[model samples]
Target: MSRERPIPSNGIVVLGASGMLGRAWRELLEELGINSRFLGRDECDITDAASIRRAIDGWPIVVNCAAYTDVDGAEAFEDEATRINGEAVAVLGAACIETGARLVHYSTDYVFNGQRDWAPATAPPYRTDEPRDPVNAYGRSKAVGESLLEPLIDSGKLDALIIRTSWVYAPWGKNFVLTIAKLASERDELTVVNDQYGRPTSALGLAETTLTLLENLVEPGIWHATDGGRCAWFDFATAIAEKTESGCVVKPCGSDQFPRPAKRPAFSVLDLSETEEVIGPMSPWEDRLDQVLIQAGLANKRRLRKARK
Candidate 1:
């Protein structure tokens, strides 16, 4: 209801504009007739304060989609990761403050320890006010960014909102759905890790929710924007197989079977109580997948038929 209120054509600038989420948000902004400036890593190095300041010189809203998303790679290159993920955010926050601009940022569910469940079958959902306990380098970096920007928000130099999401996927980038779909078509059988559970958020869905929030930029805080369901990686892979492929033998395996360098949270399903309370119930994961597949032009009869075998 609040988003229905109009925003003047002050123009929104989105960083990471070439990435999956950035592209999706760009498309939606175009549809809404809200002109946006897209700054890629090369165009405006977020690591440089002056670069960030100059890029956002005239924009009123700065949506920072730029992030170091390599979870395991962060383990090996924490400094570079921190420079991009943590310190860059502070610089951008400062730029937003100087420009009198609102900063919208992306965070991860990894901020919490996997031992704690945000959503319980018989209890209320986790509030945005819950304490964070990051378990890994990447999570720690993101937590640091969240900490660095707090002062800006407090001083009223910046009106910042952080959107913490889990298991983001999109057709435009390298993600689980695209990987699974490609594997299903190429391989005869596959074994997927089944032990991990989280919400599979489509980038398009996040982009739409962000636009809705921007349309009502006055209402700002940390919000969760993800698809409205939960499933294990294997379950999600199976769903992709089912939707894109009529039938594919997607067997369940464990993280032990295909272990990686970084330790992933066993449960990363973020409760959407706060976001849904603001934006209404999000579309289901399967529905979101369908839309993405169509958008990617991967839902053709031939592709589906090849995936089925």
Candidate 2:
């Protein structure tokens, strides 16, 4: 078990507050009565060194959720992606070091090439110490970001935690679940890729786990986090359709059927042993999804009831 720490007096500064994971973290903090300051891209340009220093100057904790997430778009704009996802993070690390602020940065499974396929029934998920070989522009950019923080963490110049997660979705924002839910409602049939394998992580659960880490003052290092269990994208989509009562027929297909500019890994399931040891086992993906959907449904009902009044 990790040692406990008192919450920072200045509260946390959440960068990229408008993004999906950031919003989820904000919601979780509010529910738990933790104080935090949220800053969107418009409010704080992470790429700007002055902006980063200014935003984090007084805060004792900084949670960075900003990133260049467009996988396909990255192929065409690798430089821009590197600037935001890689270079900017280095600047943030320096700022954290100077201000004595603990930095909590989010990373992705794309840091690994995903060439090695794992059978969940037999093989353990990819460990945290696995070699990284990112396959696409997006992955390379994220890998660079991680590399920038390594030295700072190694020398103890900055107190940092780099958490890598995958296939994250929430009720809000542009995520796989929301996309599938919309298509299932409007389309009669949908073809999804089945070759890709990974855990479908919930933003809400990830947020909660992050808070747990902060409260426990877990050691600063690389950790893998996601909802428990694994499934292919096709299975994920089908489950969503079933849960939402969407009449769409989901058909599985190979990645070749719908080729994109960037290549995707066949398997990217992350091992959560290290994370679990620190914060306990995460909720299963299906259960998290069901909870989000239920909450969304109830929120909608309240909205409708209010409108009627």
Candidate 3:
């Protein structure tokens, strides 16, 4: 709730403003009376150093939401993914270091391999310091980006904070929640993967948390930021169906049933102990989901009307 910040008066620069998270950040900033400049892919080619420099030249704070998020396509075009996700990030990091601007970069849970034998059954949420073993090309690319910034951050040359989040969905983007909501309304039965486990975070909540971190002047380091609690994709879908009154039956299916080009972590729930201690606790996923549904105009109006009867 605290809105005071450590940021400068120059205003924030947002990269990838056309994306889901970027849009959410823009909305949140406006609501909080903060000044920001948003740049889409056309305005700033992150992979090009000159373009990145032009975008963040005078800005004192930069929030990077751009990423090569095509998990399946990354298998065939790892080079493209690397250029955008890895190399581009390094370029941005270097530029931020040169300008002395605070950089808030986003990473993914895919950085870890699905096999967490350390806590097999209910695999404990991965800790921030845990070893990263990316299984697929997309994950590897993200890991490469994280590695590129490590030395700069360690040596106190770059003022940066990396936040690793999972299964992020927003009202305005192509995401799992929106997909499921649409499918449930049209289909009589829907099948979702039950083996995959992680928290579904709302982009709106994430944006608020990022602002809170800035307001508190939290230390520059890697942290996990997601809605509290976890569930399988199937469970998440069922919740969506129930909330929207879509009258669709959600069935659980094994991950092996539907193959994907990129191997996703079976259990990538991130440990939020450090994040909670530093920036306060996040709302439960169920609560955040309701808010998102209301914003998207997909809440269970039929159910509510029936109850009123």
Model 2, TM vs. native: 0.93
Q: For candidate 3, write residues 1-309 as lDDT tens digits.
A: 566655676789999999999999999988867788999999998999999999999898899999999899999999999999999999999999999898999999999886767543467889999989998999999998999988889889998989999999998889999999999999999999998888899999998888788778878879889999889899899999988889899999998999998888888989999889976688989889888988899995555446436
* Deviation in Å, model 3, residue 73 alpha carbon: 0.7
Best of the two (2, 3) by lDDT = 3
**Total clashes for model 3:** 0
lDDT of each structure? 0.81, 0.87, 0.89
**How well does candidate 3 match the true structure in TM-score terms?**
0.95
Candidate 1 per-residue C-alpha lDDT over 1-309 given as tens digits, one digit per residue, 9 for 90 to 100 = 245856558788989888878888888788878878888889888898888988898888888999899999999988888898899999898888777888899998888776643442333334566777787899989988888887777776778998888888987788989998888878778899987777889998898887787776535567888898778889888887777753578999988999787788777778787677767898889778877887777676555445547
Quality of model 2 by C-alpha lDDT: 0.87
Q: In what order do the candidates fall by TM-score, top score first?
A: 3, 2, 1
Task: RMSD for all candidates, in order, please.
Answer: 3.3, 4.6, 2.3
RMSD score of candidate 3 (Å): 2.3
Best by lDDT: 3
Candidate 3: Cα lDDT at 280: 69
User: Which clashing pairs does model 2 show?
Assistant: none
| TM-score, candidate number 1 | 0.92
TM-score of each: 0.92, 0.93, 0.95
**Cα distance off (Å), candidate 1, residue 117:** 6.6
